[model samples]
Target: MSSGTAAGRSRSRSRWRAGLGRLAAGTALLTAVALLPWLSGNDPALTVLRARSADQDPSPEQLASVREQLGLDEGPFTHLVHWLGGLPQGDAGTSWVSGEAVLPQVTSAFAVSVTLMLGALVVTVAVAALVSARTLYLGSRRRLHRATGAVGVAVLAALPKFLLASLLATVCGVWLGWFPSSGWEGPASMVLPALALGVPSGAMIGGLLDQSLPAAFNEPWARTWYAYGFAPHHVARHALRRTMAGVLPQLLPTVVALVGGAVAVEKIFNIPGLGRLALDAAIAQDLPTLQTATLALILLGTVAGLLIQVLRRALLGPALRDGALPALHAPAAFRGRSTRWAAVACALALLTLVTAGLLRDPLHVDTAARLVPPSAAHPLGTDALGRDLLARLGHGALRTIGVAVAVTAVCTLTGLLLGMAPQVGAGLTEVMSTMPAVLAGLLTTAVTGPSASGAALAVCLVGWTPYAAQAAALLEQERASGHMLASLSFGAGPGHLLRHHLLPAVLPPVLRNALLRLPTTVLVLASLGFLGLGEQPPTAEWGRLLSENQPYAELAPWTVLCPAGALVLLSVLALSGTDAAAVRSRASVPVRMSRRSRRRGVQGHARPAGSYK
Candidate 1:
């Protein structure tokens, strides 16, 4: 017993050492990377500010002196050393715009951001994990699982964080007058932001559960506990407690990723987290602020990632470590002898697309249209544009789905290559992950001038990075486990390596990403469309659908509700596929045959005699 604690402690220390090494390495890399912008000192932040300041007609001599003082005249390397050394010394350099001490202003602003993220994470993760854990337990009632899962998917699908935050502020802060809106003074100040952040984050938390729970459901020790007449909760305990083995290792990176993340949520909620800080800097093209914020986010995220790795190693020890759990590989519904259900799912998806493309109603709404309302010639109603609202929304649903599928495909491809490839540079993944997706969307919109293609392009660009990171880590597992070498020794060249070995290894995770991300893409499209970044007011995109119907919401609520429902439904459907895939994924992990005797192994499978009862 003493030895076990000692062994666990020893392993814990080993993991800590490893994590610290990664932290140091990651920090050094980030320092070098951040120096690129810091070297320029005044950065884009100062450049833009300087230009604006110049508009006030500062003399050329004054301008030159300003630049020199800001270290803009220094070479990149010199600036790097200054910024790097200065960071630990509480001197992050001066703000280009205000000519204020960058460190103080930045720190003051950043305190709010940190508080908000912590609050949001607590609310989101705690609630989401509990709900998802309930659904994941094999002993969980089927009805409970269904209810928990349905609510989870629906919530995630139906609302973007910004819109949701706005709604909460409108209702709770305004109408109900429960919480204050936009002030940073009291407990109520955090409510709106936390709620706003929590809603979507809960969905993401659910996603983590989506990964963790299914695996726990199928663990053998869990089954043994059940057979031993233990309660379902006890079995779940065994499954999940031990499950850090296979799933936790995979989950750590994502958990880390949640650190310094969720920009839109932060922006909408008025939280002072890194996301909001990055956002404010990015919009103004405040180069110094942007560089500092981004580097800080990356640094924090990297450090979180290292911590998760240590936790996973400590938690998952011998039975499940190094991605060694045996995976149950099942053929897709297409390979079954009947293949009927998979076929149906595909057929339904295709049919939805076809009906969407044609702008036809899926719900037989036209026939039911006159049963409820009356308007100009079209009883179901003309929208703000007087176009057939139902038809337009239906078509928009298709478009939304189409965009989602495209984005998911891109994410999947990126994730697979990165996760399945060993020796691939991690720098690219780091660089991409820190990019603010909303900012990217805003930029794309700013450049392309409001079209579906532009919005789609924006989402595709930002969404791919996270997936790529996930895939890269997964690939790291294969390489660390020597699977790459095994393939190489088996005469698998690069081409064969990818086609047979890598692709297969990465597909399940790719599928998971596809499921999780597709819904997000849909929400993003609708949000952008609502903001008029892509598609015009007349077009029936989901965002536009809601926008057009907002005026009529009081009288003809269904006009808006129906499309929102459809958006939510499609999002849920995509998420459901992900959930189901997770279920199948969970069933694949075999429990260790550790009882150590042949007699016990056979005894494990015996079923109780029911007789005629």
Candidate 2:
């Protein structure tokens, strides 16, 4: 009876702890949302003020009345209470600019975002899953599993949303004339955006395949099929059930990226989805709308992450699910990292194929020779600006590799610093980790007006925080376990700790994780460029090029396609490269050890490399 009571007490404590964590998260979220009215109205960040703009602005009396109405005059703590009181009742207050109720717009836009998001999921999953099934079972004509995997992965993995959207809009809306170029018209308008949104996500499908394929390839059952003399097709079909063994956990991370991509894609296509509305409101500094949108997206992303967790448990079983989250697992578990070397070789070969196809043109005009159509002169043809598709593609290799490597170096290094900084001060680390990195980004953009410096600054600051938080969390745990004492016993000081112990411990995962983020940063940079925030004209940023040429997307499909294709190629390399690395790692794990034992424990798993995984 006493033991039972102790167990009950422990469970109660556990429940209370969980509730506290939830409360803290809820408070953080609410505080952010509650401040929307005040922040949007009072902060200079919210509005566009031209040169000669008197800072005096609105009259005192009018400003007072406005504050009274908006409840901005109240202290933040008091206002927070008021906002919290209204949240339960769903009274989000009025939009600062429109003077209309905020709830309705939030609801409408949220519905649109969710609907489009769901539709995109359906399409992407269906296509990606089928593709996976085909590669696993139906077998491509070449039977080059790795090559077919690379091709499919390339198209699915590397493409950027805006680039893909622009290309699809051109091909379907221009050449085929099946879809509209811009503006939300109806259900049909959702189709193209959804397709564009779905395309890059097919990479996630490839990732899922990466996790599943190798497992299915080597499973005991697959061996059994071989013993039974089962046909290759039959074996693949039977192997699928087992392949899903590791695919579920990857779905969460994939969906996070997917949802984020969908946000950008919806914005580019002028889809009236929540993502676009949020982005529009953000750019316009429509505080209520923007806040509401951010809140909603956070909710959606959180729920998706949660749902992925639940479904992962259901599908992949508890062992795999536990291995995936809270304690993020190995890159190999997620992407098949070990096989990435082979994937790299395959990727290089395909790149060679792409290059060879271009150089063999019949025109033989150094520049123009590379410009010919899918004819004897140039296989892919000339772009709208009359540049060789192949030459631009080759040159784009620089931009593609350059943007990705630079962003990764800049952002990842920033993230590593942030993540590792907590080793010095836990309290400070926690505070910095929780600071509004995202808010800082918006502030920088609003103030500086989106130059490369501004974009780089925003990304570097925001992107680094999560990584920093992870690093801090890991080090804290290690410290708690007396690992720090052991290091100190080894004559390690701060410098030694950072370089010999922490850096060695944190660098591998952080370095690899940094690689995966390059694609996202490049995409984000492109999106900003499309919005006219990045470098100026003729610099030839892929996104900037897209925006510059958006007007002619109809007349000159090739212009957008060239850059967009470049975007896709870059994305595929990052994602597939990451996954291939994971695959390679898995295959090379000591075969003597059971797979489960080699799987990193929860704490060990949650390294930087695992985020993308």
Most accurate candidate by TM-score: 1
Model 2: number of backbone collisions: 27
Q: Which parts of model 1 are misplaced by more than 4 Å? A: 1-88, 137-154, 207-215, 219-221, 228-231, 242-263, 321-324, 328-392, 425-431, 441-458, 465-506, 525-540, 543-563, 579-613
Shift of residue 238 alpha carbon in model 2, Å = 7.6
- lDDT by residue (424-514, candidate 1, tens digit) is 5344444445455555555666567678887787777656655665555444444333334544554556875554444444566557656
lDDT of 2 at 458: 59
Q: How do the residues 84-190 of candidate 2 rate in per-residue lDDT, one tens digit apiece? A: 46768998656666667877988987776667767777777877776675556533121423423544555565566666787787788767888786777677777
Model 1 residue 364 CA deviation (Å) reads 24
How close to the true structure is residue 561 of candidate 2, measured as C-alpha lDDT?
A: 66
**Clash pairs, model 1 backbone:** 44-287, 45-286, 45-287, 113-272, 113-273, 418-471, 418-472, 419-471, 419-472, 419-475
